[model samples]
Target chain A: MIRFDQVSKRYASGNDALSQISFELQQGEMAFLTGRSGAGKSTLLRLITRMESPSQGQVIVAGRNLNRLTRRQVAWHRRQIGVVFQDHQLLFDRDVFENVALPLKVSGYSKSHTERRVRAALDKVGLLGKEKMRPGALSGGEQQRVGIARAVVHRPAILLADEPTGNLDPLLSRDIFGLFEEFNQVGVCVLIASHDLGLVASRRRRIITLEQGRLIENREQRADVGPG
Target chain B: MSARDRKTASERSRTLPQHSGGGLLSAHLEVLGDSLRRFAAAPLSSAMTIFVIAIALLLPALLGLVADNLAGLGGNFQDSARITLFLTGQTDDGEAVALSEDLRSAADVASVSYTSRSQALAEFQAGSGLGGIVTELGDNPLPASLSVTPSNREPDAVQALVTRLQALPQVESVLVDLLWIQRLDAMQAVVNQLGRILALVLGLAVLFIVGNSIRTGIEQRQREIEVVRLVGGTAGYIARPFLYSGLLLGLFGATLACLLLMALQLAVSGPIDNLLSLYGAEFRIRFFTAVDALSLLAIGSLLGWSGAAISSLTRIYASPP
Candidate 1:
């Protein structure tokens, strides 16, 4: 579960990134945050991850207020959420398996458990066979899939993605969106920030749109339409 | 999700395998292996750093060994201190022997030997290359004397014994032959103090060297560190490998220093023994005992660990997560 109450983020350069935003997503819910570039979608996701503090407001995830977490507690808090970045953020020196195993390793999972979880996640992303290959050797779509696998490898309760399909083709983007849907089906709360309006409209999921640092629309999922 | 589902998720997280004591040990061993791999990855630079550390440690160890040998030489010289009490002209050979026998019973005196006037003159004539001149003289001028070897060699105690002997009725003069030995002991003390100071200064140098080395390592792995931190890795987890790196550097450097010291000792020991033989002194060069070697290793690793801990912990905490 994630909640934001009157959240506003202002940059040091005299620019407002988010202004007076309020939203509440129930457990087991998945939503798309759609807006143009620099519409504070990344900022909102960062607030949830405790990567950046809200200038004014309370951002709550899993019933814990982000503003009150200490440095050490922030790390433990981040462990409950899986975040996928647009750039994949994979360590190029290691293979795909090692990149995906990062979350499990950080959690101190046993070697066998880590291996099993990493393989399962990689298998889910269709990257099970490429485990031995370096990220540098993978295609753009493959690297993004590795990132998705890494985000889910620890089975975090909440998953957040920022422009995860930004560099993918239409086909690859659809595949990536499908992976988030699959995770959400398993009771993981998922929030994806993307600008792919056509793809997002076709999914029939809840959509929250922003414009110029203000929430212009909060659209609920239409039950009349099934998965496209 | 329902309340039951939330409870199950929390329970599942709680059930995730926790690190047991064996797991913790394995984690450390894994980090240590990682550190060793890092060294192998950049062998030349690592070897150079270790060599620098070894040379730094070697300077102090060598100085300490020199001081130890000097102390040994001083001990030998201190044992040669002997007090001579010359008899008055009125004392006969029988009176001199009787006085030496009586002095032998004193607790402070280890041994006492009496020389008659004729024997003193003969010994002086034989030793001083003045036999012909002494024979040309009308009478033998040397006086009978008692040589007293004291059990206590401390300067103050020896001086007290000298004063006690000076009060004897038949003793014309009391001579304590210990000035050169005392000077040697003082010089040995100075050398020992200097060695300690040098060891401290060089120890600090070792600490800084390892610190700088670990700093460079952290800088090179900055991206890896960021990724680890972003994925919920603790500061200690990120620092484990670097700490091990410092430990390996110190341990290997100390081992090299020990080897260098042994080589140095072997190279010079033969010539030193020859020199000592020429002076009629039997002394052998001493190398580090097992305890000394263990201490060197312990100190080396401790310095290395501390340097790494300071450098990595500060940098890890200072940087934003």
Candidate 2:
């Protein structure tokens, strides 16, 4: 579970990136974070990870206050949360298997254990056969799928994705969200931040909209019309 | 959540980075290992860089060894260290001989020889190259001297004995010819000071050498680092490879330096030993022992760790959300 209570984040430049944003994400709940660019969606996710401290309030994830955890503890806490990026941030130098296994390796799993887990995660993303391939060897959709597999590979209680489908085609994007939904069905809390309104509206899930560092809307689950 | 209980091993492993030091450690060795591996992978470039570091480090190490050799030589000189105890003109030869016997038992005195006035004059005439002139004068100006030798040739020791000798009623003013030794000690002191300064400058040079190499590696793997971070890898996780790079640089450099130092010893050993034989000494350069090698390895590893710390900070911090 993740909760933000009156959390405000102000940059050193005196710009408030998020203004008193209060929200709670229940375990196994999937929600879409809809916002314009720089509207505090990414800031919210960053606060959850304790990458940046809230200026005035508490941001709790994994039952620990973001401000209270030491820098080291925060890093450890992050190991349990999977993050998928818009850029499909995969290491080109590392083969697909190693990149996905990276998280497990850092967690001190043995080589045999890492291989088993990496393969299973890749299998979930339909990348089971591409384990030996490099990120450069994959297509954009496949790359994003790799990122998704990597994210869910750890089976983190919480998953935060920032425009994971931004670089994919509609067909691939649909499939990506379908993958997210499949993972969600298995009780993984998924929080996706995106500018794609049609995509979020079509999801028929809870939508928390942000405007100018403020949460402007928290709508009930309702599938929009005129969407695929 | 209870969901974690059902999660497969692969599912649980997706978020880890390769640089897991431990629950308590920040993965310093992981970073160091990666840095070393990266450096090792590029044998030629790594070799050249390490050679450069070796040359820089070897200077101080070599200088230290040379200074040690000099100290060894000085100790030998001290083994032959001696003092002269002169008798007054009116002192009797029997008194001089008796004084020598008594002084021989002193704590500081290693040996003493009684030189009577006739013996002093005779030896003086034979070796002064002024023997004809001395005979024509019909009188020996040279006073009876007790040639005194001590166990050591320290400045203070010689001065202390001189003071004791001067206090004798039957003795003339005590003279010490340790000015040359004083000059040598002063020279060694200067060498020590210069060696310290040289080590410091070369240490910084080692840092830059590894740092620049890490920087280049960072640039090469900029994308990969960003990827590592996005997958929930910590700054330490992202920094491991760079740390390894710095370590490898230092280790190889140290190895190269050891080789170069050995070569230098070989090149100079035979000739230097031959030259020392002329001075009737059997001397050889002392190579570094096992402890010294360990110390060198530790130093090289430390320099690399420092470089990785500095170079990886900015680069790791540059990763995006």
Candidate 3:
């Protein structure tokens, strides 16, 4: 579950990134956040992860107010949420297995448990066989999949992806969304931020659109439309 | 795999693994091993850092040895200093012998040997090559003298003893031949002070070298660090490997420095031996003991840890995740 009550974010450069924004998503809900380039989508996601605190109002995720969490608590709180980025953010110097196992390693999972979990996550993303290969050797779609495996390896309750398929082709984008759909079907909360309105509108899921640091639209797709 | 396996795998992955007490310890050990692997991966860079640190550490150790040898040389000069007590012209050989016995029993006097007036005249004549002239002159002109060596070579203690002996009856004069001792003591004091200053300067230099190395390491791994932070790695977890890398570099540098010092000591030992023989002195050069070497290693490790910790922790917190 995620909630933003009258939340506002202003950068030190005197630029407002978000202003009095308010929203909530129930547990296990799948949604997409759409906005223009300078809109507050990234800021909103960062607030949820406590990467950057809201300038004004409270941002709560999974029943905990992020404002009150200590530095140590922030790290622990981050463990409950999985985040994917546009750049794939994988350490190329290490192998795919190492990249995926990072979250499990940080959590102090037993070596056997880490191996099992890593294999499971990689297998879910169809990257199990490429564990020994460096991420540098992977295609763009494969790199994104590896990033997805790393995020979900620890079994986080909430998954936040920031423009995850920004660099992918239209077909690859659909495949990536399909992976998110599979995870959502298994009851993981998925929230994605993107500027691809055409693809976003075609998917027929929940959409919250932001414009100029303010929420301008909130709509859920009709069930009759189904998956496109 | 099949959906059945997927169902169970998701179920198992849903629950977070329970951590035993040993888990944290193992994680720390893993991080340490990871740092060693990193060092192995960049052998040339690691060796360069270690070499710089070794040279920085070596200067101080060599200075310490120089100070030790200088003190030893001063001790030798102090040991040879003696106070000569010349008896009055009227004192006979038997009286001079009795005075020497009394001087030997004194608390500050280490040894006392008497030279009768006739013996002193004979030694002076032989050295001056004026034996025939002295024989024509008749009666011996030199007075009986007692050579007094003090048990304590300290300047103040020797001066105190000299004053005490000069006040005695039947003594014409007390001559203390220790100007060279005074100059040597002053020189040794200066050398000791310089050694301490050099150690402090070189110690700081080592710290900076280690810190710079760690800074570069952090820069190279900046993206890795950012990824770790995003994935819920604590600051301590992120810093563990860098700290270990610093410590390892410092320790290796210390070991190399010790090796360098030993090689230098061996190379100069022969020359030192020849010089000692030329001076007819029994002084031998002493190398650092095991304790000293161990202490140097400890110091190097501590310096490395401090530099790494300062750089790593500050940079980790200063930058945004």
Candidate 4:
């Protein structure tokens, strides 16, 4: 579960990234955060991951206040929430398997357990066969899949993505969305930040919109669009 | 939510277990292996750094060895100090022999040898290269002397013994041959002091070398470190490989330095022994012992670990996570 109560973040450069933001997502729920560029969507996701503390009010994840966590506790907190970046952030020097196994390795899993989990996660993203190939040798969509596999490899309670499909084709973007839906159906809370209004609207799920650091809209559609 | 769904959700909330004791050991081994691979990846630079460390360590080790050998030579000089007493001209050979016998029983005197006037004259004639002039003289001018070796060779102690000998009625004068021994001891002290200063300076040099080397390594792996931190890696985990790198560098450097010292000792031992033989001194050069080698290794590794720790703590861990 993730909750934000009257959260406002002001940068050191005197710019308001988010102001008076209040929202809550229950357990096993999925939502899309849609906004134009510089609309504080990325900042909101960072707050959830404890990468940046809110300037005012509270941002809570898994019943723990982000502001109260110490420096050492921050790492443990981040481990419970999976994060995917638009750039994939995979190490180019290592193969696909190593990139996907990074989270599991950080969690101190045994070698055999890590191998099994990495393979299973890679299988879900359709990257199981490319385990030995380096990220530099992969296509844009495949690399994004590797990043997705790495994020969910540890089976985190919550998943956050910031423009994960920004560089992908429409078909590949749908495939990435489908992977998030699959994780969400299995009791995993997922919140995605994206600007593609058309793709986001087609999902028939709850949508939260941000404009100039203010929440302008929170809407839900009831019609089931089924798996895409 | 259904009970099965709630069970799965609770399970997902629980993260993997922390590393066990065996797991921690394996993790260290993994880091060590990673460090070794890194060295293998950049052999030239690693070898160069190690060579610099070796040369730095070798200087202090060699200086210590020299000081030890000089101290040994000084001990020999102290042991050879003796006092010679000249008897009055009226004292005959029998009186001189009797005086030598009496002095031999003294506690301070280790041994005493009597040289009659004729024996002293013969020795002077043979050593001074004035045989023909000495033979033409009808009467010998050399005085009978008693050479007394003292058990205690301290300057003050030798001086006291000389004073006691000069008080004898038949003794005209007393000569203490300990000034050269005292001068040798003073030179040994100076050499030992120099060695200590050099060791301090060079030890600091080694620390700086290892620190700078590890700093460069951190810079080259900056991106890797950033990614590790982003993925919930602890500070200790991120710094482990670098520490191992510093440790290996220092350990290998010390090993090389030890080898260099042994080679130096072997190369010079032959010539040094021959030179000592020419001086009629039975002294052989001794190389570093096992204890010395072990100490060098320990110092090298300790310096390396400290250098890496300081570099990583100040550079990477100083910033917020």
Candidate 5:
């Protein structure tokens, strides 16, 4: 669970990225954060992960105040919340299996467990058969899926994706979104930030839209859940 | 796949997240191995780094050998280096014996003995094969003399004895075998001081070489490190491998230096031993002892570790997850 109460973030460069934002996300919930470029969508996610602190007000995730946790605790907190970057952040030199197994390895998983989980994560991404391939050898969609596999390889409690489908075709985008929906149905919270208004227009889920560092809309999408 | 049988391995791993990175032993070895592998993958960098460290370590080791030999250069044949005190020409037998005894009791004297004129004549006659002829002539023209052999140690003590014997009323002359041993001692001291300074300078050079290598390694793996941190690896986790690499490089460099020095010793050992034998002396060259060898290894490893630690400071601090 994440709660942002009157959270305001101002950069040192004298720009207000987020202004007095108040929001809460419950367990097993799937939500979309929509905003134009520079509207603080990533800033919100950064606060949730405590990558950066709020300028004012409280930002609490999973019960601990974002400001209260030590750097070490913040790192541990990050372990439970898997983050998928827009660029997929894969190390090119290493093979796919190692890339996905990285989080598990770092969290000190046993070899057997790491191997099993890394393969499973790859299977979920439909790339189990390509475990040894390098990122450079994979297609854009496959690479992104590898990134997804890496994110969830530890079976984190939540998945925070920033424009995960930003570069994918419609079919792959649908499949990726379906993947998120599947994980959410299995009790993993999903918070996706994107500027693709048309893509989220049909999804029957909560959409929080921000404009000029302030949330303008926080409503459940009642219009449609189109094209599976 | 059916949900019942489709459980992800990631879930299985998540069931126990604290046992995967291997225990501390494997953890350390894995890091060391990775570093070695990375270095091996780049033959040029590995060779260059090893060469620099080897040269740094060898300079000190060779100079230490030189210093050791210099200190022992003249001390090897100590007794042959002292002055001998001879009794006066006109001294009577009784007077020569008494004077020899008195000199023997002197603080600087190691030993003294009176040689009667008759005994001196006999020794000369026998050596010159004029024994029967000299025996016929009889009364012996040789003067009674004392052979005084002072202690081979303490240059100042021997010098003081030379002055005291010359001042003796009954004594005739004094001879110091190798008066320049005092100069040898002074030269050894200077060489030792130079060795220490040279070693210090070379140590800094090695540190810089290793530090620069580690810095390049950090730059090369910047993205990999970023990805590691993103997945929950701490700075310590990331630093462990580089530190191990540095230690290994240092140890290898020391080994290289020692091996080279050993080869040099073997190559010149025959000539060096022959030269000493020509002087009718036993002066065998000593290789490094076990303690000295271990010290070399430890010093090299420490230098490497320091370099890597210093380099890691900048890399870890600057990296962003």
Candidate 6:
């Protein structure tokens, strides 16, 4: 669950990334954040992860105020959530299996458990056979799948993905959404930030649109089409 | 959520039971293993750092060994610090014998040997190459003497013994050439002080070498460290591998230094033996003992750990969200 109460983020360069934005998402809810570039979608997600603190008000995730978490507690807080980056930040020196097992390793999972969980996550992402291959050997779609597998390997209660399918075709983008849907069905809250409106609108899930650091839309999609 | 999905989720939880044995010891071994692999990946840089540390440690170690040997040589000189007392001409042979017996019972005297006047004259004539000239003089002039060796080699104790003997009624004069012994002792002091200073400076160099190595390692892994921090890694967890790297560098360096010192000693030992034989001294160079090796290893590792810790702590705290 996440709650932002009149939160605002101002950069040191005299720019307000997020301005008095307030929103809430219930547990087990799935939503998509859509906006143009620099519209504060990433900033909002970053606030949830405590990567950047809001300049005003408060941003709360899983009932803990982001501002209140100590340096050590912030690390532990991240364990409860998972994140997928657009760049698919996998260590090139390691193979697919190692990239997926990273979260479990940091969380102190046993070797046997890490292996089993890594394989299971890879299977869900349709990359079970590519576990031994390095990221450089994989295609763009497969690499994104590896990132998704890594984000969910530890079975985090919440998953945040930022433009996970930005580099993929429409078909691959849809498939990536399907993976998020699969995780959400199992009671894992999911929030995705993206610019692909057609793929985001087709899901008929909740959509929160942002415009210039302001929350412009906070509603679910409908089956019927409205004005263009 | 569907019942089927719930079933799988519950099954996953059961299969991936919480890690029960997440002890600190396991964490250490895992981090240490990771550090070894990282070092293996960049052999040249790792070897260069290790060699630097080895050379730094070797300087002080060799200095200590040399100082010890020099002190041992000074001790050989102390062995000959004996006082020879010549009796007055008026003192009879019986009185000289009595004085020698008394010296044997003295607490500070180790041994006393008496040489009668005639024997002294005979010994002087035999060695001085003046037998014909001394025979022309007719009368024997050498006085009876007592060779007194002290039990304690300390300068203060020997000086006190000499003073006590000089005050004896029958003794005409006392001969105790302690100036050279005192100079040798002072030289030994200077050598020891030099060793201490060298150890101090080299110790700091060891710490600096480890710190610089770790700083470079941190910079290279900055991206990996950011990712690790984002994925629930504490500062301690992220720094664990670097700490292990520092430790291994120091340990391997210490081993290399010890080996180098031994090799150096071996290379020069033959010549040293020959030189000692020429001086009629039975002294040979000694390498590090077990205790010395253990202490060196401990100190080297400690320096590395502290250096890594300081850099890691500063880096972790300096950058925050």
RMSD of each: 3.1, 5.0, 5.0, 3.8, 5.4, 4.0
Between 2 and 5, whose DockQ is larger? Answer: 5
Taken in order, the candidates have interface RMSDs of: 2.9, 6.3, 5.8, 3.2, 5.8, 5.4
Q: What is the lDDT, from 0 to 100, of the residue B291 in candidate 3?
A: 85
lDDT of 6 by residue, B213-281 (tens): 899999988888877887788787888888888888889889888888778878988888888899887
Better of 1 and 6 by lDDT: 1
Candidate 4 residues lying further than 4 Å off, grouped into runs, are A223-228, B1-13, B84-177
Instruction: Give DockQ: model 5.
Output: 0.39
Q: Which candidate would rank higher by DockQ, 4 or 6?
A: 4
Better of 1 and 2 by TM-score: 1
Mark the regions of model 3 whose C-alpha exceeds 4 Å error after superposition: A198-204, B1-47, B77-81, B93-143
Any runs in candidate 5 off by more than 4 Å, and if so which? Answer: A5-16, A53-58, A68-71, A222-228, B1-22, B79-83, B90-170, B177-179, B288-291, B318-321
Clashing pairs in model 4, backbone N/Cα/C closer than 3 A? none
User: Between the candidate structures 4 and 6, which one is better when assessed by TM-score?
Assistant: 6
The local lDDT score (0 to 100) that residue B181 gets in candidate 3 is 80
Error of 4 at B143 (Å): 5.0
Q: What CAPRI-style quality would you assign to candidate 5?
A: acceptable
Q: How close is candidate 1 to the true structure, as a TM-score?
A: 0.90
TM for candidate 3 is 0.87
What lDDT score goes with residue B154 in model 4?
Answer: 78
Q: Ten residues in a row with the worst lDDT in model 6 chain B? A: B8-17
Q: For model 4 chain A, give the 10-residue run with minimal summed lDDT.
A: A219-228
Total clashing residue pairs per candidate? 1, 14, 0, 0, 5, 0
Q: Mind giving the per-residue lDDT tens digits that candidate 5 earns over B28-49? A: 6767777888988998879888
Error of 1 at B65 (Å): 1.3
Fraction of native Cα-Cα interface contacts (under 8 Å, chains A and B) also present in model 5:
0.43
Write the candidate numbers in order of decreasing lDDT.
4, 1, 3, 6, 5, 2
Query: What would the TM-scores of all predictions be?
Result: 0.90, 0.82, 0.87, 0.86, 0.84, 0.90
Residues A91-139, candidate 5: write the lDDT tens digits.
8878999889888767776677778888889999899999999999999
| Residue A123 lDDT (model 2) | 86
Per-residue lDDT for A1-228 in model 3, tens only? Answer: 788999999999999999999889876789999998789888889898888988899998766798998777777777877899999999988899999999878777887888898999999999889999999999999999999999998988888999999999999999898889888887788999999987888788899999999999889998777554
